[model samples]
Target chain A: MPLQNIKVIAFDADDTLWVNETFFRKAEEDFCALLEGYMPKEEANKLLFDMEIGNLPLYGYGIKPFTLSLIEAAIVVSKGTMPIELVQKLIDIGKKMLEAPVELIDGIEITLKELSKKYRLVMATKGDLLDQERKLIKSGLEKYFHHIEIVSDKTEKHYKKLVKHLDIQENEFLMVGNSLKSDILPVLNIGAHAFHIPFHTTWAHEMIYEEINHPNFKSFTKASDLLQIL
Target chain B: MPLQNIKVIAFDADDTLWVNETFFRKAEEDFCALLEGYMPKEEANKLLFDMEIGNLPLYGYGIKPFTLSLIEAAIVVSKGTMPIELVQKLIDIGKKMLEAPVELIDGIEITLKELSKKYRLVMATKGDLLDQERKLIKSGLEKYFHHIEIVSDKTEKHYKKLVKHLDIQENEFLMVGNSLKSDILPVLNIGAHAFHIPFHTTWAHEMIYEEINHPNFKSFTKASDLLQIL
Candidate 1:
């Protein structure tokens, strides 16, 4: 309830302060059009999602595998009807995803500007080399983080690694984000505090359990709405 | 262009037929507030991003790990200030995502109904088990799809698997939807016809390359606006 003894605060990227997944969705419709007559619209999406799920272990989080996956899907769907020129364009579409600009959520800048005054912020996320860095730079929020880790996994080991690298005790750190899995759970497991914030577009992969009875778990309903509370 | 030899049509899920990402976004803002005095807002987001990136491998796609990621970020940001009472509520958000009824995109059902008359329809998407199924069932789109496959990856192997399973050829299929990686590129890669219909709320991973110069690769700028082309 009362803000007391707060030391280091961690934030989640993607859907937290800015919009991320929604942009990826824009490409989905474009992708579906690539295979109109061969398979059903939903079948094609299933195929791509399967590739993403399959490649997650090998590729982690990035656009390259997704591109390759699309390429692979195109090949399967082509089945002899797709033209070379058209296939080339489809491949290009996959590559273009790498360069998408970051768009922050509304009211985010003002809320962050206000919250920055009271907390020592850090960015803890999982993504590829260029994608995450590009987002940070594009979002104009990179300067705020004292530490940035683009990890392949977010297991307990990962959290412990960050704690060790930052030299911040669990008790002295707090986590925040739209994801309970990466944003809240591990940090809480380590005896740190956590805040759960539900987002609108909960990705199928990023969604996780919420915390209610932990020694240090909290939640809010809005961005700037919480500024006065803090 | 004129419809030629088009028979069965496939649709990609996520952004093609409905709006999905808006939910997670609203949740993230709530997650960020737990880090009042510990960290700045930007720092908190970066940390949350780190955590999400970490969870990509472990959870892959679904609401489970995503929710967990948020909870973890909350803990890390709190640094001990996040009250435990909010933890359960945070986890509940994940369940809420599943429980939330499917809200179709503007004119999705109408478009699908119209398109079904001229082509065979089915759904092809890659996502978490319960999440996609729940969405499909609640959206009432399940009846339209003659074949539905919720696979782990969308690769050549999987497409071929679907093709063999569904007894369809690439030339006889057309994939439509809002994802480039899942719907466009992969279907194109397989020598099949593909369509690119762009959606506004695409996911980051699903967005891919775009090409306006393909023979078999067709696209519609708007979802329900497809009728205008004919």
Candidate 2:
């Protein structure tokens, strides 16, 4: 079950191609510190996670929604007495996150460059379109992708749509990414091959508690290993 | 010419199908009020507009980017001494815009319901994916559209890509929307038929000072008028 017949290799942009979840982790730490007076760091972190999950339907995914959730959590944790100063600080935190430099994962460029020569490469990621497009432009990897899809969510249906738009069969598609929740499971469920390249920091929302074993699934420790796997 | 042989009829979401720019206008006024201590409303509006144009490439479009621009403008206008309250107020303004009710333009439902019977209706809008999707879902008119495209920009290249993806000839496509800059000119430039139904309030960025007249173009005062023309 090697990548023998796959004609399209789609890469997930965030943690798989570049460092993403680490910045979020750092932002969460900073958010908790900013609200330490209201609640302990652990409690504050849990409340923020709850707020993010609760607001997912309303805000979808991205730094903006995360920032909004941070504001809402601060107000709730502080019993609506949260000063405007802390709220502004939270907004600044979000701005800094958006402005952060895109640090590509080790060996991503060589991997993509090499893969592009053989298979059609596509970027499939879900986030704020502006932020994601900015990150892609900054990464300087846009030229390698044949197509880029900034979708609302990565469900089985979305993967099917991507394959249909690419005019490729499920067996001809392969997805690679860092998150089992977003990148691997849904793709595998759609009967497409998926490879998981673990990043050190995974967002709480993207964590999967149970191990998934599937015939179309493979795990690699580093992106460079993908060159040999394919 | 009638809409005979038209294979696709696409509508712009923001001002074409529903009320959108008015909310942005309201947000701007609220933002200026929040920063009234630092600058007059007119001056602040100019500066914010300048910042938005400057940050367009980096932030693209949507309430989130607009919110970021508001924050950046406040910091610059206040010379880094802006109070936290103002920043918080800006964030709230953005949230309210996102939360604003989706009020469809008069006769939009009848037009869509009628046009959808004879033509392939699509939603071609430029905005944040989440915000646009939320608005479509809230509009309760999602079922009328055969396809929905939330794109980064509306340009000749974008329209070409859309027509190609939809598997239709440019001459067989018709675009209907409010903005001449975004909806009309680009579509007409790409050799597609376009109809303009003017909205009462147009954003500065969307305003076209020069008149555009093309053989493939027609003007309507209201959405209902499209029923008779097509």
Candidate 3:
């Protein structure tokens, strides 16, 4: 059956609507390079990931927390001997990430514009508020969204609460995003329709090794592909 | 007359419901001490404040952004001569701030418990999403609030949007907080009632030098005072 009853269509802002994870990947490469004198590239990446996972409860997501984790990893790996200059360089990397231009994924504008005409479009993404708001404004896609929810995490409870707030029945809401862990599974778990548009580069944290098979779930390789599905 | 018609009563989380600004103040003192070798206390504070205001558009608010600003200020003030130990110390300061316990204001529990019986209680505060969520969970006051909004900033437009979301008319909503700039004036400007219970120490950014005179506005010296007014 077609998703004909869906009245609200929400899009994830990061990699789904725009280029995001790629920047993180790039930053990680530079971050690993900065700490090579203290540890191997593989060891540095593992330590940084461990720090990020451990800090999730307190620091949440975004470049700020990532930067902090990098510093912490540096200190731990280098046994507190990491140079001050290197720490300053890490801070600069974070600043550069924050200042990175908002590059919308291909066909996002056309897809959003088309989808907005038929449904109540909303932007649901998790990250630092100012950074996300800045990106939204830069994307110039705010006009298409009826509501924007910058949540801390995308848990099953959070999605349920969001659907309740939007006042739409679960079956009548659809979510589109790049991360199956964050964007797809939670909505699917709630019995809501979800579309996964895989990006070229996915963060290890966002990777889902398990297979997903749900009646309401769909996958697309491109944003424009959503046109045919919806 | 009485605020008997208020259907929804929202409180600002930081400073108003609990001790928040004091932590920031303490952190600022510690931050200044960390950089004392590089610049005078007064000069360091002025430069840090300037960096904070300048970085506001990029970093927004909260300890993460504040921490980043501190690093930037340190680099500029020290002319890149800042020691690695100092940078490490600054990171520690931020971690300490984040790990600080959520200390509720006097009589907040009773006030919220009593008020929750008669009105829909909500938490409306601006800051990092993760930090705010952690504080709310730690506060043990989450059960009292029906909804929690961790917004980017509290502007008149944002409040209007919130009231609309709650499906409450402006006259039937009341906002209580410590900052007149954030919690009081904006609500009053939108034809809503506001209560100001000032904290002992206020951030310079939150200070409102102008006089406020509104029929729907009230001020109190204690949280318990709210019980009598309501």
Pick the TM-score winner: 3
In the order shown, the candidates' DockQ scores are 0.01, 0.35, 0.61
Query: In model 1, which regions exceed 4 Å deviation?
Result: A1-3, A79-81, A209-213, B1-230
Model 3: what is its DockQ? 0.61
Cα deviation in Å at residue A123, candidate 3?
1.2
Question: Model 1, A34-59: lDDT tens per residue?
Answer: 67777777888887778678646534
Candidate whose DockQ is highest: 3
Q: Each prediction's Cα lDDT score?
A: 0.66, 0.86, 0.88
Interface RMSD of candidate 1, in Å, is 21.7
Residue A166 local lDDT, model 2: 81
Please tell me which model should have the higher lDDT, number 2 or number 3: 3
**TM-score of each model, paired residue for residue:** 0.47, 0.85, 0.94
lDDT of 3 by residue, A88-129 (tens): 788888889999999989999999998899999999988777
Q: Local error of candidate 1 at B2, Å? A: 76
At residue A190, candidate 1 shows an lDDT of 81
Residue B66 of model 1, lDDT score: 61
Rank list by TM-score: 3, 2, 1
Candidate 3 structure quality by residue, lDDT tens digits, B194-227: 9999999999988879888889999999888999
Residues A43-138, candidate 2: write the lDDT tens digits: 999999999998787678888788777877887778766655666688778878889999999999999999999999999988876688778989
